[model samples]
Target chain A: TQLLEQSPQFLSIQEGENLTVYCNSSSVFSSLQWYRQEPGEGPVLLVTVVTGGEVKKLKRLTFQFGDARKDSSLHITAAQPGDTGLYLCAGGRTNDYKLSFGAGTTVTVRA
Target chain B: GAGVSQSPRYKVAKRGQDVALRCDPISGHVSLFWYQQALGQGPEFLTYFQNEAQLDKSGLPSDRFFAERPEGSVSTLKIQRTQQEDSAVYLCASSLDLGQGVDEQFFGPGTRLTVL
Candidate 1:
């Protein structure tokens, strides 16, 4: 089974719309990270939320860590075409460097 | 200068062929990782290096896969007798450290490998 699972395997929205992607897991993580990847490239770090219930904002993207440390969510306000890509979530457990990853959410923002 | 870098942005191999993918980590980084990503799937861990030592290789799919970081900087992942199932995007990442779980891994543009 996948250690981390993301919802809405795919999403398509018009530019300027708002949407949220979820990353859920059964195992607790010491730290969780969200990444965005464009085609033909590796995933890029978007945000890393450590503390439970932690919320971080990267411009229009708001990331939240679940209180149980087993889930996370990323909400994009006023999405732009540039935001169209694959969003993946990874988690690092205590004393582990190898992160477990989720399948990913592919987002498409149409103009 | 700010992130990891990989060579041979794309690779195509035939069955039973041998291939080597290289990864140049961010300077001064202590942790290096290798991951394989299949189409439409997330990156899966393959191996890890801390400086010049390989600390974890349990994630490697099989014995046919091998990796080395002889200089503690540039790393190489070599695959022998590659099969079609071995085709995937190989990514490299570097971080400060993995001891206390404080480092954030910076990734590079992965090399997409297609085995026919």
Candidate 2:
């Protein structure tokens, strides 16, 4: 079973639309990270949330960590075509070198 | 390279053939990791190395898989007797060290292996 679960396996929206993606798990994580991957490239780190109830924003993208650290959400406002790609959430634990990843959400922003 | 670099961005091997994928992590990075990713799925942990020591390898799928980093820099993942099911993208990542709270892992473009 995938330790981390991302909802809305595939998302397609207009260029100006807003969208949200979720990552859930039963196990608590010390830190959770959001990454965006483009075709033929590696995933790039977008943000990291280490504290429960933390909310972080980068431009139009907002990331929130749940109070229990077992869930996370990414919201994009006024999405652009550049936002189209696979969005992955990875959970990490203290002292553990391995990251548990979710089966990612593929977001396609139509131009 | 400023970031992690992987060799042979794409590889095609016949069934029962052996293949080797190489990864060169960022300079001075102490942690190196290997992961396998199937289409439409997240990358799964395969193995990990700290410096030149392999601290964890519990995720290796089978005995045919082997990895090594002899000099604490470059790493190689070798698979023997490849099967069609072994086709996937192999990714390599590197981090400065085990993070106290947050560690950022920089990933390579990944090697796409196709077993026929």
Candidate 3:
């Protein structure tokens, strides 16, 4: 069973539009990470949030960790064609080395 | 520096045949991980290694799936009996440290396995 749930299994928006993807779970985690994956390749880390209620910004992308640490969100401002890919959220526990990943949201930005 | 790499980016196996996938992690990385990703799904953890020790194998699907990292750098995943259901992408990741809360896992391009 998948431990994390992501909304809007797929998202398609035009260039310059804004989009937000959410990851939620009932179980709390010590850390959460966001990754973007392209076809025929592995997922690449975008950001990691360790504290609850923490918001991080990477250029035009914004990431927020829920106060309970059981959920997280990723928002992209002015989406571009280059931003098209699969977005995945993974949760990590205090002592466990394995990560539980959400099914992921496929985002497509059209020009 | 070079990132993690997997050999034979694509593999095709006949049903009931055995196949082996190899992963070479970044140099000096202490943690290695294996994951299986199905179409339209996120990668699922398969196993983990801390140095040369197999720290966790709970995620391994069955005894048919076996992994080893004897020298702590190069690892191999072997499937004893390939089945159609075994088709998926196998990814290898490595981290500089042992903990996941603070370290970033560098992933390889992955090996796509197809069992007919």
Q: What is the TM-score of chain A alone in each candidate?
A: 0.98, 0.98, 0.99
Better of 1 and 3 by lDDT: 3
Off by over 4 Å in 1: none
Candidate 3, pairs of clashing residues: none
Residue B30 of model 3: what lDDT? 96
Q: Give the alpha carbon lDDT tens digit for every residue of B1-116 in model 1.
A: 66788989999999999999999998998899999999999999999998999999998999999999999999999999999999999999998876335468888999999999
DockQ of every candidate: 0.69, 0.68, 0.75
Worst 10 residues of 2 chain A by lDDT: A35-44
| Best model per DockQ | 3
Per-model root-mean-square deviation over C-alphas: 1.2, 0.9, 0.8
lDDT of each: 0.92, 0.94, 0.94
Select the stronger candidate by DockQ from 1 and 3.
3
